[model samples]
Target chain A: MDEMSAESRYADWIAVHAGQSDLRAWALAADGSVRAELTLPSDSAMPEAPAFEAKLLDTIAPWLGQGSTSVLACGLTGLADLPEAITPVPAKPAERLPIRVSANDPRLDLLALPGLSQANPPDLLLGEETEVAGFLAGNPGFDGVLCLVGPRTVWVQISAEEIVSFQTAMTGEFFDLLAGHSTISAAVASTGMDAEAFVDAVSDTLSRPERLSQRLAALRGQHVLQQLDPSVARSRLFGALIGAELAAMRPYWLGQQVALAGPSDMVDLYARALDTQGVSAPRHASDGLALAGLARAWFAMQEHAK
Target chain B: MDEMSAESRYADWIAVHAGQSDLRAWALAADGSVRAELTLPSDSAMPEAPAFEAKLLDTIAPWLGQGSTSVLACGLTGLADLPEAITPVPAKPAERLPIRVSANDPRLDLLALPGLSQANPPDLLLGEETEVAGFLAGNPGFDGVLCLVGPRTVWVQISAEEIVSFQTAMTGEFFDLLAGHSTISAAVASTGMDAEAFVDAVSDTLSRPERLSQRLAALRGQHVLQQLDPSVARSRLFGALIGAELAAMRPYWLGQQVALAGPSDMVDLYARALDTQGVSAPRHASDGLALAGLARAWFAMQEHAK
Candidate 1:
């Protein structure tokens, strides 16, 4: 119960993810079991580098012990800007070495993971790279498109355990803005989405994606005419956005094996859109994948160090 | 001043144009000349009906007389929602009579003007109807199309003084949301758009509209690759959005006499895009058009009342 057991538990490392608004860290046992988790719900992406160490300690300091804890980080990496994130198209997703951050706490050895970027057709992604790496770790033989749908939907073409190329769309952010802030919000009901309406709207826009702007305005018009139900109109607005995205991404997914990752509802929505287009893509729960990717990257680092 | 002069000034009717965020009123003298103006900066689009009078008096109380003054109101009509706003497509702009409100003040006679709407491809406009009407009043023989750009852009096809059909786009609002709030902001400079970049992006997108999302992501990519200037990327993003809009609106403006009305900057952008397509659209400063339309509606109401 004394030194040996304490060493076993305290030898554990942490996997960290800092998003646009929140910070999350997982306390993992030496055997790779997640023993506990900590979350700081705001101001994690503080733009300044100094905020990272304190924000990390605020959540996982109690878990730190006599030995140093290696913290592998991604997303905003607890900072709004990281100068060293790699442009890793045509390279393995998790191949880049983690950047050793200057840690003030001797008990904390922090490493911010490098995010992937595409040089041409320009796009960049942070935490999604880790999730993609996790996906590859679980299915090493996978070789095709992976559509990670989130605040920004990222579509990466993977082959031989590396990302060949990728593109991103603002569909998720646009949907949130339109449904929550735009005048379209008044035309549609706040809570529910009609499945049929969503599919129908997607089909309509996919056939002629340029009509997206018109289709959106039509939702408002339908509201004025008292024609479409509020929920139906809301779903249509959502469908229209995704449809346009799918249209743009046609080159990326068409005639290729596709996989999906993200929040369940988003995965389901993207899956439905793909299903309509006769594409079958396997789905992965994105919540745990970032940590899995972080763990994989850590293990790789250990192997490299050896 | 003397009693007679006070009466002359107080008898002036006020034409009010309330938008989603601001209220503007032009005080018209008895002879139909604009005597003065009033502006209420915020919260003027209060949804409650009772707010109409208090907001009205906050700006134009000094101009009020012992006798009742006709207040022609449009836009949100000092309210967020108006049940009686008419869907009046295929009718002359500003032809609808003002809806009489239940005014508590004997000296405050308020009348809310009906906004025009198209039921078919679904579109609605409040203050824009007044602007179109103002445009028609100034150019009575004009009979083609009007592109009224703002936070929400409206496209109206006119024939024989009637709005035969119309459409609306969220281009302006989308630009604001993307440039100000989305990740795109970090990729682009905060201000100053490059003209060549804007024109080139418009040309690129107008040829392939479905690539709108990709073009946006490319701006972010360009940032990571350090290939494009920040202001150039920003302008390209702006151009891509407008170009997509122009593509969607091809049917609306093709082979038609078109007029552009909006803020000077927006008008210039639209005009440039249209110019790329070899279409020359006359520019109309939208600042006074709303009040002019409101005044026109007020005069028409007076004629009907007589």
Candidate 2:
């Protein structure tokens, strides 16, 4: 089949998701094969609805093509869940039906998905649901915990195609806040990840999590008084926070077959922290999972249409 | 003796201390009586050395007439510990020798006290030691844990006029970061602390401090989803951080008589939190205690000089 006719054989689609600071887009073939993926800085002014829609389309223009490629996007806040496309489904754990929005744009066919919300334990996820959908699609009958380690790290318990219970930690966000703006910023470097300090600090905090606040301040004190290395201080701060998080998340991963999906650095930290807890979590690439998730949702829509 | 002759008899002095954001000055009569007290915003450029000194002198000029009054200042950071007047003393539990700096300013006879340092467990205190000193002087023969709660809250175990051991927590600093700049800022009001939420949060977190980071994020989530009152959120955040601090300091207060000295709001929180732990810590006025501590140190210097 020629390239033009071959493209015509399958419906091409685009999957886009908005994050705290960025919007991610992935072009996919009908068979759930990712063709291209890219990211653009997102507008945080989420309440200003149509402006963001215009921004989203403008951001993804480079990937938009001549073909009638359908766009499937997900947003957690109400802005993405337009009244026209919303289909409220009964809440279930493994998979909840996402409300969708029809992108009323002439350049491309677009559908935006509603973010997931759980009443019990009360949690929310904006763009991560598609990633979970994609991961579940790849690992059929996967019954375990799915942890997405990022600015907003989330741990979800899944069984029999339902999300059982989940919890989130602002661990990554806290690290950013401290390292970027707080007094501890002096003791933390921007890019270096100290493996030894990370592991040791994790062990130290897990053994004595109550000393968290003191230890956090001690990073600055140690730097001034004890000659604590800035790189190690950064790692220790990271490790201490993640360590405390794992302490609270112990019940979630203690006996579960755990896996992580996120950026490399965060997943590495999460995976390493879990190892110390005697829980080994394998990591999958975040981009693939996100793209696969969008494709899965698009295909599911087609099936439902039939 | 008349008031003027009485002031001249013993040589009146002033004790000033620099805090994280404010400079507190206390005027004292020859007999260690507090004559007057006031505060001014501190120059944050602490490392510049002379600026703080200038600021100290400038802030206290209104109280500094040509009365042959001596001035002693305490700096939390070593920045204020200039070399000229330093008197090194042996490290003891209740007190460590503070390095003193002769202000050398033509306007007044000034000496600046250095903060205390511990070689093991590696800790530092700026101005609190003076307050602790003054606290001890008034309550002579008093023995137990003295907690000076502020930006850097310190718990000192004292016995026989020596600081036996001390620990520090940056609980106040962490709350400032979260409530002012971090993600939790969205749910926190700049002013108005909620006492009920503070107590309840203290109780909840005292039992489960490992969940500190999670509970913090939950405050924002609760605000977004459940419309949690902003004041309550502020109190909850305050309670959680303080509760964690109390958890770590449990050893210091569990079986010991505890008393608090610091800003009223902070001391009240600590006292309330301690009360929840079944420990009744008598609240002492911070300004008076700080002045007393400085006066005690000055008199100790007079005795040492003789």
Best by TM-score: 1
Highest-scoring model, lDDT: 1
Residue A289 shift from truth in candidate 1, angstroms: 0.7
Candidate 2 docks with a DockQ of 0.32
**What is the fnat of candidate 2?**
0.47
TM values, all candidates: 0.93, 0.82
Candidate 1 lDDT tens digits, B103-205: 8778888787777766566677777777888888888968899999877798988888888888888888788777777767777755787999999999999
Candidate 1 docking quality: incorrect, acceptable, medium or high: medium
lDDT tens per residue, model 2, B13-101: 77777776677887777777766667777532234456666766666776666644577777643445433222222234234333445
DockQ in order: 0.57, 0.32
Weakest lDDT window of 10 consecutive positions for candidate 1 chain B? B78-87
Could you give candidate 2's per-residue lDDT for residues A159-252 as a string of tens digits? 7766666788888878887787665777786578899899988988888888887788776556656767888899999999999888778878
